[model samples]
Target: GESVGLHLPTLSVQEGDNSIINCAYSNSASDYFIWYKQESGKGPQFIIDIRSNMDKRQGQRVTVLLNKTVKHLSLQIAATQPGDSAVYFCAEKGDAGNMLTFGGGTRLMVKP
Candidate 1:
């Protein structure tokens, strides 16, 4: 069996500091990746995304980096806020793209 998941189950950061969440995927054929932020009692929200063809992509306050060589992915959040505290998930899709395989998720706790 293969696994596609977060490397850490939790991450704690100061409100003004930056945060980095990591993920690993077993399927090398996966060509698309997405990072999602889920706050308490809400659905997952799209944070950022990266393609296998590109190593990195950025959004408002988020960045997604992918390393196909190691099947690794990371999400970087700038100036983490209490509002940013949530469970973050990394997902991958093969050529089909929309059919996603998700990571276990890393809970980001921003301590003010």
Candidate 2:
């Protein structure tokens, strides 16, 4: 079994600043990783993803980076807004199958 965990339980950022959230995974064999954002009551929403073969991936306002050497993952958000305030999680899927192991989550607060 694999486990994922965030370095910080909470992250605070100003409305127009860039934010970085980090996570660590226990499984060195995990080949796929994803970042998700969950609002106050809704389910987790897909943000971005990166595979073990790739070091970095970019989305609209987000970037996902994978450091297989350290079994670490990170999500970077540019010009973060209040709408970005939510709980963020990193999930990993290994060769074992489709099941994804998710991290506890980091609460991101975008201040005005």
Candidate 3:
């Protein structure tokens, strides 16, 4: 359910523009939400996180909005750049081991 494929695998944007990536999760009991950016061949890097108690959280040049009502989440990237090109994954904390269940990844393509 939370493992659905992304709407678009690759998003192309010009440098200095903003980009938005979307994801949907099925588990409502998920307490913690995290956004990660994975460059080619690299592991996912933590961008920001928010608890179920909060609806929105922000980080440097990034913002995450959580809508528990609809079981949806989104990531906003400011000032898109070629260096920012990577695959983004949204992960929800599982009930058992504090491990994360990752969503289908979205690849961002920033054109210079």
Candidate 4:
């Protein structure tokens, strides 16, 4: 059975610093990846995404990296801000159409 998980349960960063969150997935067949940010009491919001065909992709202040060799993925957030504090999750969608498998979220806390 394939699954996704985060390397850390929480990450704390100073405001304006960069943040990096890591994740690992056991599913080799997955082709699409998405990063999501969920504030308390809110649904996950799309942050950035990368495809298996790409090693890296950047959007606004966020970047997503995919490493197929190790089945790993990472999300990088630049210039962390208080508004960026949230629970972040990485999800993968494979050949199974729209079905997505999400990893347990890692809480991101930005300090002033």
- On residues 1-112, what C-alpha lDDT tens digit does candidate 2 reach at each position? 2243435478999999999999888789999999999999899998888889999999999999898888899999999999999999899998897899888888999999
Checking candidate 3 for backbone clashes, the offending pairs are none
Q: Which ten residues in a row have the lowest lDDT in candidate 2?
A: 1-10
Write candidate 3's Cα lDDT for 59-81 as tens digits.
Answer: 88999999999999999999988
lDDT of 1 by residue, 1-112 (tens): 1254536478999999999999888688998888888989999998888889999888898888888899999999999889999998888898654689888888899998
For model 2, state the Cα shift of residue 83 in Å.
0.3
Number of the top TM-score candidate: 2
User: lDDT values of the candidates?
Assistant: 0.86, 0.89, 0.88, 0.89
Decoy 1 TM-score against native: 0.89
User: In candidate 4, what are the lDDT values of residues 1-112, reduced to their tens digit?
Assistant: 1244535488999999999999887689999999999999999998898989999999999889999999999999999999999999899888777898888878999999
Better of 2 and 4 by TM-score: 2
TM-score-sorted candidate list, best first: 2, 4, 3, 1
Cα lDDT of candidate 3 equals: 0.88
Of 1 and 2, which scores higher on TM-score? 2
